[model samples]
Target chain A: MADWVDACATDDIEEEDVIRFDHGSRTFIIVRDHEDNYYCTDGLCTHEEVHLSDGLVVEATIECPKHSSIFDCTNGEVETPPACENLHTYPTKVENGRVFVEI
Target chain B: MPRDYDLLGADAKSAVANGLVTEDWYRTHLDRKTMKALMKRADQPAIWDTVVLFGSMIAFAGAAIALMPSWWSVPFWLSYGVLYGSAMDSRWHECGHGTAFKTRWMNRAVYQVACFCMIRDPHCWKFSHARHHSDTVIVGRDPEVAIMRPVVVVRMAANLVGLTDMWDGLKRMIRHTGGRILPDEADYMDPVFFAKTIRTARVWIVIYAATLAAALLLQSWIPVLLIGLPRLYGCWHMVLCGWLQHGGLADNVLDHRLNSRTVYLNPISRFIYWNMNYHVEHHMFPLVPYNKLPDLHEACKFDFPAPNTSFFDAYTEMLPALWRQRKDPDFHIRRQLPDTANPYHDGPARAAA
Candidate 1:
């Protein structure tokens, strides 16, 4: 059974930003898109596991800083080359300014 | 027998079997905040560098064209060639990594421009370099290994002036015009990009043809000199600095310190090479942008072998290694890790001793 785990405060991540969140053992990212919608995805790039939190966030897509592999944070779908596999995403919720992710 | 460096050959399979393909190399771990700061991208440094590079190129080219047919123009032409022929290699590299500028389009724009200047098909080289980083110095896996074992002295000497390199580039470009990818290239290239790779080659042929036509119509060597010939004339700097990157280092090593060199270069050469003198650092944390390489080098310098003090120092060390490798292919310059460095985090590399 999946439980909504508190990832971070909604205000902790700025708009159009991503912050790394480690829950138990797995690492994920809390991304606040340009429209202020909260999203969650695996923090490591599918290609080489370089942290996606270090990557450039352009609206909805996060570009890998190492090789420029881009992915849609919303769906975790790879949007670029050199990285064929899509990322694993989690359902997220915002409750009273705190962000929770069902991983 | 000499080791096979062919990407599709036996050693390619060996690299896979040996667990050398994309194995995690040792890193000097830093906090996420620090790493994020180091990886942050900005546009100003790249903007200033690009403006200076192109601005000087235009000045030199204009002066050279005006003074053409006179020996007085030689110096200006040489300067122009270094910018167009040699330095563009670094631009192609940095922009290809998408770290040169914060804006994605800017990196793409410069990458395409640099690819044309270097006579490199952008897509082909992009994938080639991606593989290079993924499996650096692994025999038969890394296509960009500059000096393969037994050190073909003749080929190395010829490439100083880009004779063999440009010749091969021309041949590759010709093959690309026919919409054919070399079988070896196909091994690592994604099928998704094959069409655009061929398209890029076709576009280059048109551009080169136009430059040649202009020269013929004007009854002058000016147009070709401005375009195609510079890659031959001014490629010396590229080869000089590029060879020092991994010329005599241990091959098939999972650790970059074992296979890459960091040499101190003069400021002018650093500018020309886009700070790639920090070779080991660049290979280790490729996410770090070119402008931030010095900072990254500082952060991790304690964890690796000390950088060569100078170009002279680097070559002095490499020359004898190369000479010996010609006799015994397995003989290589073993890197001495610093006391603070963690033990080499890798499987036993062949002949690492």
Candidate 2:
């Protein structure tokens, strides 16, 4: 069973941007790629705790500002270190243009 | 040669005896065949090791995320390991000197790996580190020894506290603040070389940045922070290792015997650090691999410049010793010319006067 949680409204997010959302006690970065797709990933970098929202989004890849650990924004797969671990992904979608993350 | 004689002559032995050599069960790097074989180990920059280094970090990051912890205190060991792995480029540097590898191309390849990993140009580092070795502690000449003044350290401290270490580091990327005076026959000093270095270094920075971005996309920021912050810490260690290893020690003009200082250190330090604690020996030969340092230390323990003066002692005793004076003392400073008994006044003089 999929448990979809309402994360944020459409107006809450800007285009081609990422915002860190605190779901429960844990934090995750919610990004809208250039394709206008919504994605949610663990907020902190796996290699270090630099905020992913603070990272640069080049196409589908998100680059950590600290130490340059890169990750695939869509699937949360690691591209490099100071990180080697894949980012845990939350199933996300948009309804009425509002982003929703499945826990 | 006798085993005992070989042992006695080896630097590793002195390293071991002094407790600076690490790894209890080390194959004594004595005898020509053994020496050659041990030296060959430098050639074994295995992809497996690199992969392991790469994979283990990923695995660690994953584990950290699964069992998510508080932000107040997070483990950042993996970051340190990543930094250490990158800094091992310095080791590749030693190899590039042809001290690590017998084959020149092999050494170049190793250096290239280091260059990519650290985001610094291998050729540039080779030239820089080489010059540093040739001119140890020659003020305004040696790039490595051109320590940031106390004021700079304070400025850097403010920047770090303000979360701008990276920014400050970035600013320094293009500027060559150190090494005002160039040595004679400076073969490596060229504009083209520096341009290439900057480009290579830029590529390195990009890769590192991309790696961080990937982690963020993967929702592994905690892991990146935990695993990556250690790199900064490791950089601190590198500085300490370099500074304490050579700083405030006997600074000689030409004589390796009278100039260098050796630390008779504990084995744990040597083991983790690969006998680099015996830095005097390293700077003297630069060809003797880490494994062979013990043997060399044993042979040259009683020779000039003395041995077994702990860096710890210098930190504890000498910090006050130097601090009391405010600037680095001329404890072992000497002049190359014939006029003065010692080129540097030994007992006491105004600091930096």
Candidate 3:
């Protein structure tokens, strides 16, 4: 069984944008791709612990503002170095116009 | 005695103790929407410019090769070198900031190309530039200070032909390839980038070695001329334009208006320099794209000192100031701002006011 928490409304994140979702002490980044799909991953950049939400989403990749390391939003895979580690991806779903992520 | 400008030297420690490092610097106010508009990045301008730049480089190099061993070859090669070596400096700078293009990959591609042209290690220079923006012209903290007081005339002259920069760049690349980072570089660079920096250096060395081997195998200067050697011959304009940005300007000041110069240059120079002639505006708003710099300048001109009328006018003021600074290290060019401009409120200027 997975604990799925309500992150935000479906309309909260626009295309090519990201929002930071905090549940208790944990934080995650929810990104909206160009196709309007939502994906969730660990919030911090593996390179320098910078918030990925502060960065820009280009196509399907989220570029870290600090050092420009990019991660694929779809798979939380490291697409660029300086960040050699892939982010942990969480299961995300939209139900009844609300976005939810399994933590 | 020559002043110590080293980032890890006593001067830097003194700057920290004197409350210079990481202190809040003055900024001209911009409306939120206007600021947002200026920061907006676009790919069209960058793509168009990239096409033009590379297109010009290829055309010029072709002309040079066709005219080889003739006096006509000199002009074509010189043009190619300027495009490759000089213009690449600004391209490297803008792309490194990641604000030149809306697409991340596009910026990265241009950055890599410009990095190779300028002989800069992308990983190291990227972090160094971030620090430069964070602590602009802060004595002891800034790694990119071009002209230190008691100006070293001979060294500055040597830099005009790229002798100094190329030698230093080679030394740094060798050191990086050997798995060593300078203490000053280590001071500001994140430890996470060290391995990547080394790897990049190794790649650059291999490329250069290959180019040299190609030239030796063919017994022709063409390979070197097209690749590594152009940086030395074509770097004069870059050094010339770069010195105007901050040479003889105020140092250790919290206001960029005091520390940086914005000179009006011709369209060609602006294109080559990528609008960095608006140096103060760029420093003030590092996120602003190069295309929007003129707009940013227009928006904030009231708060800034008047831009130099032209490059010649800027050098007229700068040359004499550099001359005086050689005798008096404390001397600097204090620019006159318009009455409409806000007063600079840093250091002694504030107390005097």
Specify the highest-TM-score model's number: 1
**Across residues A56-98, which tens digit of lDDT does each residue of candidate 2 receive?**
5545666554334568988889864336678988898889867
Of the true interface contacts, each candidate retains a share of 0.48, 0.00, 0.04
- Tens-place lDDT per residue, model 1, B1-353, is 57888888999998887778764666677766677678778999999999999999999999998998899999999999999888999999999888899888999999999998887888788888988988888889988888888888998999988988888789888998898998877987777778888888988999999999999999999999999999999999999999999889877777888888998889999999999999999988887888899898889888889999998999999999999888888888887888988887655555343
Best-fitting candidate, scored by lDDT: 1
Model 1 bad stretches (over 4 Å)? A1-28, A32-37, A48-60, A77-79, A96-98, B348-353
- Worst lDDT run of 10 residues, candidate 3 chain B, spans B344-353
lDDT of 1 by residue, A45-103 (tens): 88778878867676887887667798998899997668889999999999998999997
User: Which ranges in model 2 have alpha carbons more than 4 Å from their true place?
Assistant: A1-103, B1-66, B70-73, B76-92, B101-106, B116-119, B146-169, B172-188, B215-229, B250-252, B257-259, B266-268, B309-311, B325-353
Chain B TM-score list for all models: 0.97, 0.63, 0.97
Off by over 4 Å in 3: A1-103, B347-353
Model 3 quality (TM-score): 0.82
The global C-alpha lDDT for each of the candidates, from Candidate 1 onward, is 0.87, 0.51, 0.85
TM-score of chain A of each: 0.97, 0.88, 0.96
